[model samples]
Target: MKEMEQPVLSVRNLHKQYGSGCAACRDARRERLLKNYCPACGTVYACQDISFEVFGGEILGVVGESGSGKSTLMKCLYFDQEVSAGEAYLYAYQEGRQNIFAQSAQQKRYIQNHLMGKVYQNPLDGLRMNFSSLGNIGEKLIAAGHRHVGRMEARGRELLAHVNIPEYRVKEAPKSFSGGMQQRVQIAKALSNHPPLLLLDEVTTGLDLSVQASVLDLIKMIQRDFKISMVIVSHDFGVIRMLADRTMVMLDGRVIEHGLTDQVLEDPQHSYTQQLVQSLL
Candidate 1:
């Protein structure tokens, strides 16, 4: 019998909340909060028992409106924010035996540099505005322990070119680039370490329509060429439709619907999901 392939990333029962929970919101069965907020204790539950898996060479799309916890989920996965409780396993790290959320801070930094990459909603979050485009990629390489300047520059140039950044602009700071170009540079930087998993948080949110299409196309190309698993968070169904093989819809910090992208779009089971799909039509 052929063995089932291990998932590249597995997240289970993940939870992140701002402020400690009180009796009013702590009990799962009895708690009734206002859209993931504990009115009584003033706690905001950012992610609630979130769970999902990403297999090799596939993109998993997380779609939700603002405050749905999708972005927060991404942050938790990338270790930008500490998870209140949960287990996340990555195949590339310790053969998926260790729960990443439980790892020490130093170990988490290793995972961030070598096992996974992230492109933030704001390029400023991912790239140093004052640094050149190549320097940004070099920074990730350096974090991954690369020291040879010649080799690092070669890699930086290769990734930048792969993302369609012109050779002439490699030395330019990201702040000098347009919104779309800055995102492209960020993508190049994220790919510099050749990580197995990538997390993208609304990578195309603020771009012009034409630029958004171009960035989306570039993302598709990257997934196809690199074969890296991706977890992309977006409020735009269009972006999700274009990139995701499977989709998870979040609402009030909970996953209300999950399925193949086509299936979820065609037969949405949750009321919020149905409304979201209807908005597209």
Candidate 2:
């Protein structure tokens, strides 16, 4: 909880447009709800004018209903999806001078391998189900250029244990593990390189309440142990309230309100945020 005067990542005026932009997109643009099909042109604006900053050792929560473009924004940041416009920079890379959006494929690959970790909503998206838990985490180390098999395997054991996954399961394929265990393996894989920034998208969405609690506890432990910055996307306020230091409320693909987690929860200014907080109450 030290003073975070510098941000680990900064995103400015980010946008993602799907389909041919036509006249209907104009209304979508005006309203900033460009994430859906345009009534006039049927263009899909998956994201528009998105901007945010994540500070070192801080968790920034992005909350919104499904299809609010929050997931699209995370995809853009992780380079899984392309952006139509705007810039994103990682402070840990090139001293925060390099724009991630403009990086060459090689440079981006290096960044992805060394400086970023992402846990997808689906374990299959983030992990190789057929690979053993150890192999899943080891792949990340290999990508980061760790060629020593012994060292990679050691790191894998360390990560799995750190995430509270039993060491006995290290050699088992994720396909054979339970849903929660698969998620733990995904988290361990994501953390293999000790990345400075971690992106989590709906990580607890489909889990049972007990499983969700355990996963959330594990994430909290990781955050404390690593002191890594995070951008967590979730529709559940309980998830945000439990983990985020700051929260951003997204509606119709736009951030309508954002501030300290306590402030946003206690004194929500946006109508949508107010409704969300009230629903919890």
Candidate 3:
């Protein structure tokens, strides 16, 4: 967290919308839209001028209610969804000089395969249900240009083991595993490329309380052990509190507050953020 150290991932003026915006919704500075939706043109601004930086080995948590654009932000960052407007720079890609959003399809694919990894909220979205856990991890390894089967298999086994997936179940497909196990496998696959940045979208949302705890613990462990910068999106303050080094609170597709986790939790400046912190009490 040194002032002179460059951020691992830097994003600026990120915006995403589902429909073409009208004059009423075009000028977001005026705040004319109703909760990110324009009545006249039916445009839904999922994210508006969202900006943030994640430093190396730091976890930046994004907490917001459903439809708050947090998940959309993650999708845009991971290239699962295209951004309407924005620029994202990764230190590991072109020395952070290139705007990732503007990269060519092939260049973007290279970034996705080698510089970043993402774990979707739904296991099905992140994993091939029919593929064995090792196969899933191997898929990522292959994309990263690992050609030797022996080396890839070794790396896959090491990652699965790191995520606490049983060796016996390495050959088992995620379809046969529990929700928690599937998530673990997804995480293992995401980590296969050893990407400097990892994007996780509501990873513990559907899990049981005990299962959520285990996954949270696993995340913390990964952060500590791998020292990879992460952007974790969740609606739960509890999850953010447990994992984030810094927190950003989003509302109506805008960032209302952001600071160190403790600062935001202890002295929430915005009313919406206050309500969120209160709900956690």
Candidate 4:
């Protein structure tokens, strides 16, 4: 896909608070402690005033430590969690900026199925463990309005092969596969619909070093081949270094810094980002 000047995804002032508007939650937002959890009202500011843009065919990396709310940012963009406030627009869905946060359930469903694909850090969160690899992909296709069993299975098999799963194993349950393979299946399933956007949250987090490299390689290859835009969230700078064209450094759910990947990595300005870059050195 050719690069476009306009962003494929534009998110502004997004917030995801766990509890209803209590004084604690309001205070958390006011204090800018987006990662804070208050015992007073049991509110967790999982994400706050998060804003960014993902250009077409670009892999935008979001890096932050645990509890920094980077994952929550991706979750909000993927529509897995409801946003408490703010607006998000997917250019693929509409020309005018549509506040996706205000969209109806049906509209959200359409965006998820037709416009974006998501792969989670835990394969279990993304894949149907009990189903065969083919069945798993078929389910995603079915959600996208595919009903023909023959065509669905064929597309599923093709994707399994693309992901380097043995053709014979296509009939086997994903639960029986190794962790890395399960992740591969999840990737294949996510790509079945050829979505314009992909959301990957710590996809290589727990794998062995070599396995992580392999999975990361596959992701890079998929991006190159499909030319899909990706929002990848990881704490590992190595992953960000290998995959992202641009990078965003998140802290307390806020994007403290964002720029071209090399520029940000090489010349970090924020104190937190400077520390993060040095630690990886």
- Model 2 residue runs over 4 Å out of place are 1-4, 27-36
The list of candidate 4 runs beyond 4 A from truth reads 1-4, 21-29, 32-35, 38-42
lDDT of 4 by residue, 116-190 (tens): 899999988898899999999988899889999999989998999989999989999999998899999999998
Residues 1-281, candidate 3, lDDT per residue (tens digit)? 34578999999999999998888878857377889898999999999999999998999999999999999999899888999999999999989999999999899899999989899999999999999999999998888788999999999899999989999999999999999999999999988888999999999998999999999999999999999999999999999999999999999899999999999999999999999999999
Per-candidate TM-scores read 0.98, 0.95, 0.98, 0.93
Alpha carbon deviation, residue 21, candidate 3 (Å): 1.2
TM-score ranking of the models: 3, 1, 2, 4
lDDT per model, in order?
A: 0.93, 0.88, 0.93, 0.87
Worst 10 residues of 4 by lDDT: 27-36
Give the clashing residue pairs of candidate 1, or none: none
Candidate 1 TM-score over all chains jointly? 0.98
TM-score of 2: 0.95
TM-score of 4: 0.93
lDDT digits (tens) for residues 1-281 of candidate 2: 44447789989999887777765456534553334667666667767788888888899999999888899999999999889888998888988887899999899899899999999999989988888999888888988899999989888998899888887878999999888888898889988888999999999998999999999999999899999999999999989999999999987677889899999999999888999999898
Residue 141 shift from truth in candidate 1, angstroms: 0.7
* Tens-digit lDDT track of model 1 for 1-281: 11277999999999999998898999974257999998898999989999998899989999999999999999999999999999999999999999999999999999999988899999989999999999999999999899999999999999999999999999999999999999999999988988999999999998999999999999999999999999999999888988999999999999999999999999999999999899999
Tell how far residue 93 is off in model 3, in angstroms.
0.4
Give the higher-TM-score candidate: 2 or 4.
2
Q: Least lDDT summed over 10 consecutive residues: which range in candidate 2?
A: 26-35
